[model samples]
Target: MPSPFRLRATALTTTALLLSALATGCGDDGGTDEDLTAQKLSWKDCPAPSQAEGGGSAPSPLPDGQRWQCATMKAPLDWNHPKGDTIGIALIRAEASGDPSRRIGSLVFNFGGPGGSGVSTLPAFGTDYDTLRTRYDLVSFDPRGVGRSAGVKCENDQQLDAYFQQDSTPDDAAERTGLLDNTKEFNAACDKNSEKVLPHVRTTDAARDMDLMRQVLGDTKLHYFGISYGTELGGVYAHLFPKNVGRAVFDAVVDPTQTSEQGALGQARGFQLALDNYAEDCTSKIEDCPVGDTPQDVKDRIAKLLKDLDAKPLPGILPRQLTQSAAITGIAQALYSKDFWEFLTEGLEQAYDGDGRILLLLSDSMNGRSENGEYSNIAAAGVAINCSDDKPRYSPGYVEGRLPEFRAASPLFGDFLAWSMVGCTDWAVPGAADHPDVSAPGAPPILVVGNTGDPATPYEGARKMVDALGDGVGVELTYKGQGHGAYGSKDKCVQTAVDGYLLDGKVPASGTICA
Candidate 1:
């Protein structure tokens, strides 16, 4: 089913990004009745969604759970020409639970993949909306080029599989060279295969789509909740339609202006910092962390493990390579969900035992390879979205040159993670113009959340985004949690403060720290 917040990517496409004349956006208090009337005749014919086989339409499927209705909202394929070539976004609307006497309107959610499908997030975030949903329709959708949307797929599935065969973690120069060559070939394939939608995957496109969704749902305003890349998406929408924002919450915000190279460099430091904290926690449960005693010791052992796999590929838990690429992917994925922290040791053990099973599973999940050896529809979109959203500059020497900074900042993940963005170096076009619209943001004082030790988005990033968004007049909410998105984790102290802002429209006083 097409989902919301989460999305997929596309191949390099043609851009006839002719700015279309769209109706004026809804005002800050959503819009006046006149605003609604003004927009009534503007919506185009949207493609109707196909019914999910054998499902009823309630909130979600809950014969024992709930049911869901497939909803579609029409948006311009390119917003600059709003009334032009139209594309329809699919949505799953989970209505409020309580008395209809007090409905809130709508709460659109974004789950972070830039490729993650958003359909399944309702049950996940529904609890928080309990009070709010009583009044609002919870709308979520997979952005264009993503699932359920007329998706963007590249290369026949088989050729795509061939690209995954390289040694993820290269031991010798030969494998590393081959990997780089493959990345270029892969990028070329994307350009040739899915060139139609690639140029249109910018965050601004998604933001405009959300506004269309709001009008279709008949909501006067947008009560948006964004996390991770989702936060970036929301920021773009707010910037584009500042007055349309009504009690929006941007958790784990992203500074879209930040380059992937800069982000990777910063993340190198953040991951190691988080790992250091994990190490402390690791020792409390397992003697020597079951990985290694000292931080450097653990790094050495993992490095040795990487080299071992480089020489001989193991029959990992999955059919992928047991290369350092596999291990690093596993580590990066684990870095986000502390609940999965225990898996690190297990992944380490399997790799250490020369099994390479657990690490493979983690790697596959990350790169979107399936167990039966099928690639996921999500990966195509993931790469497309990221490459298009922010065309990173990773030359042959980019990784090596930045190694020292990465190492100093993130002794554990510096080199490997920095190289991860290297794939983008070979991307055909540099990402779309960095949403020039984002340059000016007079959007309300949005709150920016940063964990003291978030691996994916550094604390510094949170600070940077908050400052950038409000011209250095935003509030920073720090929850001493360890995960990619912490707001929904039910950390009472954090929730109360965030809820007050959303429900009461009260900004946390300046310098609010929620730990």
Candidate 2:
């Protein structure tokens, strides 16, 4: 069976709301943009320890869904004080049925989000990921500060509603300043409100929580596949608990080593490349894809359209207009699935004319918001997880300085997208994780999968992490595919490679390219 691709049933989104809850510690650049430089920080740099979330001993498993049960686990709101009070962590389990005698211990999975929720996945992914379910009793969880488990909400729904509506791509100095100020305010609010939870949102805490789950589950070893940001979680696990590793597969991996600027730039370039792919495929499908005959032409033309939107958002069905931020929401959604490419074209066409329905739908999907005014717990957990994982440079002037370059590279949606992280600047109760180098020391070989044109987690990141892991154990398998997570999209070649690795522990031979 192929290793499962995480969450095709759900669309990608951002969890900016959590940042506002974390406002206590965000920073501003008093100096010029050039003054913003990567600071070398260490474990000592983490935020001060705080009070844990409900420290009543982590609760036991609860009846939840078909093939899965919920288990309440807990870790310190601060890992530094492991013996201190603990917070409840939501966990889910789906045990193998076919032959329990052949069980391969528990496999824990984390679908990445700075705010991604693992608990919600059981209902969405269910047995569709049977390969993983059939061997180990697959476990998923909502790390602290996520849905149905616990969260440190600072802003009310109305404030969050207001925040998402803010244009991501700032047009003039005023718009830019407004966005900056709003972000600072949001970040500051989080710092003050979520004092306890914010201090423990780091990946290290989540990883440690996972370790506690592993022990609680009675699994002697940890077998898992972590996609997108989940890759960082696995890397940290490997770095901290190498002895516990087992049959680990990191697909569409993240390069945890890069600085925030490098990371953002890498994403910008990846989106540019993915957009090139979209243009080619889009033009092949539609005779008039806006730009000239060439793909670059389409890219350039689309770039111009975004800039136009930024300057004067065109009116649409809803109160909001078509802005560069909205365009990006559409573009990123399309990059997630080849099937959604038309959404981008339709959105562009609507913008060319005057419609915002399709664009709003894309934004809705990107925001992971439901029609009922509520949002994804996955997104909520994602921000909690991301803000605490590794520090991103959030100086006030940072976005202003890099705005031009990001916009130039991602003309359709770059500048405001770059500014999307303003809330992190004032993140409170830091408690960040250590930069774990995950080489799977002395452990069995780890399979690293990459899709050629994965926009969110680029293929190059897979290569970079693989090379950095140094141990002779790293294996890279390139799927000549598109989109974000690629392990389970079902191109026979890709499926076969992953199946071979997961079942037989066979790493795809180096230089192996599977389409």
Candidate 3:
């Protein structure tokens, strides 16, 4: 909930199972230096994910019995001085299953938390890309300041629980002051706890690290798959090293044209659209929707629930009540995927009955909390990177002034998101630009896939990314679907288009539509 603008598509399968138990459940950067790129990685069997990566078991082997391998690649801590101190970039891979002669080099992927741990995420969805692995080593890594890569650390788990529980949408001056104080305290903790890494975790720094990664991996060009925030990193890489890009694909594309404020506003509209779609889908079903009698009814009930919760909180996972902010966060989490819409309906139904378990569980997932109550570094690193990359810092007055416009965009989510713009307030380091520079004139044709109903990075971003990447550089493919990303949605048309391009170098015609 730190930077609501941050996009992530974490697996919710385990989360769904938890909900059935009691109707409630538990749950970077850097650069260069020739010697760094030439360093060898000692691949080993992956250990259980560290607490910072969101604790879980070691990744299981692929369906074909090929084991997943792990390694650490050293990269400069600061891109400005590549030969200075270095940090390890943790990596994971499943080698190609096909003939060595048919191998098309490593296909690197960034699953996009700007903080999501590729070291842990890739295996969770490994089988989804087995087709591509037939001819390429499927690879991913924990970007600097994430997971095992000297991950940025802020408040201790206890501090974070209190931080997140505080009122996020203030109704008066006292509440507003509390919100700003909390934001400042959180930022100060990040600076206090992660001063060494905070200033160096911008997207531009991560892009340079990818170039070094390509060299270390023995690939001539970086064949990449970027989703959500990953798309922004890819675009920056293309702009910085256009000629070195090869067979890249960006799904859930971020708009390179907007400032941090504009991006947040766009998310307001995008999420409202997704919520509308969710309401319509639920009510239009042959079976009666348990949450409401009609589409507007569904939304109306949800709005009233939020209003009621604001005034009087409900019991959530024991010892933690579901506050209004948590409910909104949970709702936003459920809207990320249509697959989770069932869970959303159930969560709403349960919340209405005074059982806040399901909704709070969803909120935990969004905040990177595990069933055992530990949190991943996703929140810390997301705030660090966003604050470092985004130049503008908004005052409480500015947010107050924009409330009307944000509310106009989304009555349910507007206040929550508008207040999130202050996540960077009183930060430790200066930001890099008004927005990322992604104009890559000479980059290869990068396939850009957009989902019509993506809540995080709205569909319009795909076309903007295509145009910004320069004509002929970004090939646009539209998936008339509902999810944060298309390829992962398992739409056959999307899979085929992406596989053809990444596997056989077959770029779909620009503006290709997949319904």
Candidate 4:
């Protein structure tokens, strides 16, 4: 799904990366050396989520059960000076179900987003991993700039509400000026409210925190399952401590090889391809589909709707109107999973009938705007982490110059996605990061999963990631399906490959395809 805060990947087939894992060296200290010691975690029961007051949706509630233990860990704000200004890393651990004597070690899970809340994400899946849960404690943490941890806060609800309602697909100089103005406004809000934590929340810092968590959890090596953007985190961890890398799975892999602009174009094409796939499915499955029989027709219809919305906003569910931005977001949200296609169809059908409540609602859902008018910090954190992680340089003229290239990439969704990068131009901190060179020479075998029809992270990017990690060390598992992620799906082949790797150190043969 194209959240205003997520990253993108593209198609560029290359040779698989392979290099046998052999004993090698430790990572060069990026800067300072302070003692890296584990901190004690005082586990306590988690409080029940605040109930949604009246109508609309709240984010999915924490799953019931007392199996969850909440704790906070102290980590340096500056990894170079570990003893200096510390920040809290919030963690949630679910104990294993099998015999205590048979227990393996802690299994760390990250659900991408650079901003995704592992504390919220873990509980929904800890039980579903069935066998793996019994053998190891499933633990997840809110990385420094996310969830209960020291988070990045930007514009408040009122400001963001108005921001989301702005027309993203600007048609003229005036609209373009407004778009850039809003970008600067949001950027300024983040710098004003989160200056202390913004520069410190880089991927390297989070990877360093993971190592400390492993030490605290008493694991000799790290066993991790990271999806989407999480794959980048896993890659960084493996590169930093190759010897400490145990069983690791990087699913829906992001190519650590691409620059930010390349990644954007890649995602533009990927989302376009996914929309085509959705169009094909709709023509065959749904009766009287509004998108039509061919992909081109679908693109044309969507383009027309966006143009119309740009010219005149539609009446929506509440005070806000359905602007081009929300319409694009709603469409992109459904493209993430095939299961959400029906909702997309309903939303489009309603829009066709001159009522935009469904599409507007879906957009709000994707953006994490709560029913009671409060907004989640996800959008803020997402922008903060991404901009800090990779400093994007694009003026309005520069981005405008790339418009034709973007539209050529994806006729319906390209321009909006490409222009979304403008906010990073004025990012407060000059990014001191890049995609980490992830060929960890002596790491244990790492499995990378790719979905053939994934929209957010393209299949080709997965292949490229494997190539970057090296062919000998990285194994590719393919799911011939549609979705942004492969694991936790009903695909038995994927489940078996992932489970076997995490539980029994079983590696799927090279070129393993899971349909």
* Local distance difference test scores for all models: 0.62, 0.61, 0.88, 0.75
Give the TM-score (vs. native) of candidate 3: 0.97
lDDT of 3: 0.88
Q: Could you give candidate 4's per-residue lDDT for residues 18-116 as a string of tens digits?
A: 001100114632333334463568988754422111122222323444367878888889887777888888888877777899888988988877677
How many residue pairs clash in each candidate at the backbone level?
A: 32, 27, 2, 7
lDDT score of residue 59 within candidate 4: 25
Residue 8 local lDDT, model 2 = 27
TM-scores for candidates 1 onward, in order? 0.83, 0.82, 0.97, 0.91
* Candidate numbers, best TM-score first, in rank order: 3, 4, 1, 2
Report the lDDT tens digits of candidate 3 across residue range 24-143. Answer: 300022235768878998999999989898888999888789999999999889878888899999999999999999999999999887799998888888999999999999999999
Per-residue alpha-carbon lDDT of candidate 1 for residues 392-448, written as tens digits (9 for 90 to 100):
456756567667786788655665666666666666656765332343254566767
Name the best candidate (by TM-score).
3
Candidate 3, superposed: residue stretches over 4 Å from native: 24-31
Winning model by lDDT = 3
Off by over 4 Å in 4: 1-36, 49-66, 290-295
Better of 1 and 2 by TM-score: 1
**Candidate 2's residue-wise lDDT over 1-515, tens digit each?**
00011232344322222212222101110111211112121111111111111111222232333334565665566666665676777666666654777777877777765455566544455555676555667677766776545675655555755666676566578887887777667667666777667767777666666666666666667787787877877777776676667788887778766755556666776777788888888677646655346777777777777667667777743555556666666667666767667667766676667665566566655655554455554444455555665465466577678887877776554564566555456555452533445655555677788888887777888888777665675677788888886775667777677767766666778768876
lDDT at residue 238 of model 3 (Cα atoms): 90
